[model samples]
Target: MLTPDALGVATASTVKTLKVEAPAARSAGIKVKSVEELVEKLKNEAKVI
Candidate 1:
Protein backbone atom coordinates (compact mmCIF):
# COMPACT_ATOMS: atom_id res chain seq x y z
CA MET A 1 0.00 0.00 0.00
CA LEU A 2 1.28 3.48 -0.82
CA THR A 3 1.35 5.75 2.22
CA PRO A 4 1.03 9.51 2.03
CA ASP A 5 4.75 10.08 2.72
CA ALA A 6 5.76 7.54 0.07
CA LEU A 7 3.38 9.12 -2.43
CA GLY A 8 4.87 12.55 -1.74
CA VAL A 9 8.41 11.29 -2.26
CA ALA A 10 7.46 9.53 -5.50
CA THR A 11 5.72 12.62 -6.84
CA ALA A 12 8.73 14.77 -5.95
CA SER A 13 11.11 12.54 -7.90
CA THR A 14 8.83 11.94 -10.89
CA VAL A 15 9.49 14.04 -14.01
CA LYS A 16 6.56 12.92 -16.11
CA THR A 17 3.16 14.49 -15.94
CA LEU A 18 0.69 12.64 -13.72
CA LYS A 19 -2.99 12.78 -14.49
CA VAL A 20 -5.45 12.24 -11.64
CA GLU A 21 -8.92 11.08 -12.49
CA ALA A 22 -12.14 11.72 -10.64
CA PRO A 23 -13.95 8.80 -9.08
CA ALA A 24 -16.97 7.32 -10.83
CA ALA A 25 -20.35 8.48 -9.62
CA ARG A 26 -21.79 4.96 -9.60
CA SER A 27 -20.71 1.66 -8.17
CA ALA A 28 -19.19 -1.09 -10.37
CA GLY A 29 -21.97 -3.51 -9.32
CA ILE A 30 -19.84 -6.48 -8.27
CA LYS A 31 -21.96 -9.34 -6.98
CA VAL A 32 -21.29 -12.00 -4.35
CA LYS A 33 -23.35 -15.09 -3.58
CA SER A 34 -23.03 -14.85 0.20
CA VAL A 35 -21.69 -12.70 3.04
CA GLU A 36 -19.42 -15.54 4.14
CA GLU A 37 -17.75 -15.63 0.74
CA LEU A 38 -17.15 -11.90 0.86
CA VAL A 39 -15.61 -12.16 4.32
CA GLU A 40 -13.38 -15.05 3.28
CA LYS A 41 -12.13 -13.20 0.22
CA LEU A 42 -11.45 -10.09 2.26
CA LYS A 43 -9.46 -12.07 4.79
CA ASN A 44 -7.51 -14.35 2.43
CA GLU A 45 -7.51 -12.72 -1.00
CA ALA A 46 -7.75 -8.94 -1.03
CA LYS A 47 -6.63 -8.67 2.63
CA VAL A 48 -8.36 -5.33 3.17
CA ILE A 49 -11.32 -4.28 5.26
Candidate 2:
Protein backbone atom coordinates (compact mmCIF):
# COMPACT_ATOMS: atom_id res chain seq x y z
CA MET A 1 0.00 0.00 0.00
CA LEU A 2 1.14 3.62 -0.66
CA THR A 3 2.14 5.58 2.46
CA PRO A 4 1.70 9.33 3.25
CA ASP A 5 5.47 9.82 3.55
CA ALA A 6 5.99 8.17 0.15
CA LEU A 7 3.27 10.41 -1.42
CA GLY A 8 4.83 13.58 0.12
CA VAL A 9 1.41 14.91 1.24
CA ALA A 10 1.43 17.86 3.66
CA THR A 11 -0.60 17.48 6.87
CA ALA A 12 -1.38 19.75 9.82
CA SER A 13 1.73 18.55 11.64
CA THR A 14 3.92 19.49 8.65
CA VAL A 15 2.47 22.99 8.24
CA LYS A 16 3.91 26.09 10.00
CA THR A 17 1.83 28.44 12.14
CA LEU A 18 2.11 32.14 12.93
CA LYS A 19 0.79 34.57 15.58
CA VAL A 20 -0.59 37.56 13.67
CA GLU A 21 -1.77 40.84 15.19
CA ALA A 22 -4.07 43.60 13.93
CA PRO A 23 -2.78 47.13 13.50
CA ALA A 24 -4.05 50.04 15.57
CA ALA A 25 -6.74 52.28 14.05
CA ARG A 26 -6.01 55.88 13.17
CA SER A 27 -7.50 58.79 15.17
CA ALA A 28 -10.66 60.60 14.14
CA GLY A 29 -8.54 63.52 12.93
CA ILE A 30 -8.53 67.13 14.08
CA LYS A 31 -10.43 70.02 12.54
CA VAL A 32 -8.36 72.66 10.72
CA LYS A 33 -9.24 76.34 10.56
CA SER A 34 -7.65 76.90 7.17
CA VAL A 35 -6.03 75.11 4.21
CA GLU A 36 -2.53 76.00 5.47
CA GLU A 37 -3.11 74.17 8.77
CA LEU A 38 -4.34 71.09 6.92
CA VAL A 39 -1.31 71.11 4.66
CA GLU A 40 1.01 71.48 7.65
CA LYS A 41 -0.54 68.49 9.41
CA LEU A 42 -0.42 66.35 6.26
CA LYS A 43 3.26 67.18 5.74
CA ASN A 44 4.43 66.87 9.36
CA GLU A 45 2.13 64.27 10.89
CA ALA A 46 0.74 62.19 8.01
CA LYS A 47 3.88 62.66 5.86
CA VAL A 48 1.71 62.03 2.75
CA ILE A 49 2.51 65.32 1.04
Candidate 3:
Protein backbone atom coordinates (compact mmCIF):
# COMPACT_ATOMS: atom_id res chain seq x y z
CA MET A 1 0.00 0.00 0.00
CA LEU A 2 1.10 3.59 -0.62
CA THR A 3 1.33 6.27 2.04
CA PRO A 4 -1.32 9.06 2.01
CA ASP A 5 1.31 11.75 1.45
CA ALA A 6 3.73 9.80 -0.71
CA LEU A 7 2.68 12.04 -3.62
CA GLY A 8 3.06 15.82 -3.62
CA VAL A 9 -0.17 16.61 -1.76
CA ALA A 10 1.22 19.39 0.43
CA THR A 11 -0.65 22.21 -1.33
CA ALA A 12 -4.09 23.82 -1.34
CA SER A 13 -4.69 23.48 -5.11
CA THR A 14 -3.92 19.77 -5.00
CA VAL A 15 -6.41 19.24 -2.19
CA LYS A 16 -9.10 21.21 -3.98
CA THR A 17 -8.57 19.36 -7.25
CA LEU A 18 -8.72 16.02 -5.44
CA LYS A 19 -12.00 16.73 -3.65
CA VAL A 20 -13.48 18.57 -6.64
CA GLU A 21 -13.42 15.53 -8.92
CA ALA A 22 -13.07 12.60 -6.51
CA PRO A 23 -16.84 12.16 -6.41
CA ALA A 24 -17.05 10.43 -9.82
CA ALA A 25 -13.64 9.73 -11.41
CA ARG A 26 -13.23 6.83 -13.80
CA SER A 27 -11.25 3.61 -13.19
CA ALA A 28 -9.65 3.82 -16.68
CA GLY A 29 -8.99 6.30 -19.52
CA ILE A 30 -6.69 9.18 -20.46
CA LYS A 31 -8.48 11.56 -18.13
CA VAL A 32 -6.85 9.74 -15.19
CA LYS A 33 -4.15 7.40 -16.37
CA SER A 34 -1.94 7.39 -13.28
CA VAL A 35 -2.01 3.56 -13.03
CA GLU A 36 -1.68 4.14 -9.28
CA GLU A 37 -5.47 4.76 -9.23
CA LEU A 38 -5.22 7.19 -6.33
CA VAL A 39 -7.32 9.99 -7.79
CA GLU A 40 -11.10 9.59 -7.80
CA LYS A 41 -12.70 10.41 -11.19
CA LEU A 42 -15.79 12.44 -11.74
CA LYS A 43 -18.78 11.43 -13.90
CA ASN A 44 -18.34 14.28 -16.36
CA GLU A 45 -15.14 12.76 -17.78
CA ALA A 46 -13.70 16.17 -18.53
CA LYS A 47 -10.02 16.95 -19.09
CA VAL A 48 -8.90 17.86 -15.56
CA ILE A 49 -5.76 15.80 -15.67
On lDDT, the leading prediction is 2
lDDT of model 3 at residue 12?
Answer: 43
**lDDT for each residue of candidate 3 in 1-49, tens digit (9 for 90 to 100):** 6655888556445434334434666587454567444344442344366
Candidate 3 or 1, higher lDDT: 1
**Tens digit of lDDT per residue, candidate 1, span 1-49?**
9887877665455576679799879957567899999998889988997
Candidate 3 lDDT for residue 1:
69
Q: Please rank every candidate by TM-score, starting with the best.
A: 2, 1, 3
lDDT of each: 0.80, 0.87, 0.51
Most TM-score-accurate candidate = 2
Clash counts for all predictions = 0, 0, 4
Which ranking of candidates, highest lDDT first?
A: 2, 1, 3
* Residue pairs that clash (backbone atoms under 3 angstroms), model 3: 24-41, 24-42, 25-41, 25-42
| Candidate 3: residue 44 Cα off by (Å) | 37
Show the colliding residue pairs in model 2: none
What are the RMSD figures for all models against the true structure? 12.8, 6.2, 17.9
Clashing residue pairs for model 1: none
Lowest lDDT 10-mer window, candidate 3?
38-47
After superposition, candidate 1 runs with Cα above 4 Å error? 1-29
List the lowest-lDDT window of 10 residues for candidate 2.
10-19
Q: Which ranges of candidate 2 are over 4 A from the true structure?
A: 1-26
State candidate 2's TM-score. Answer: 0.42
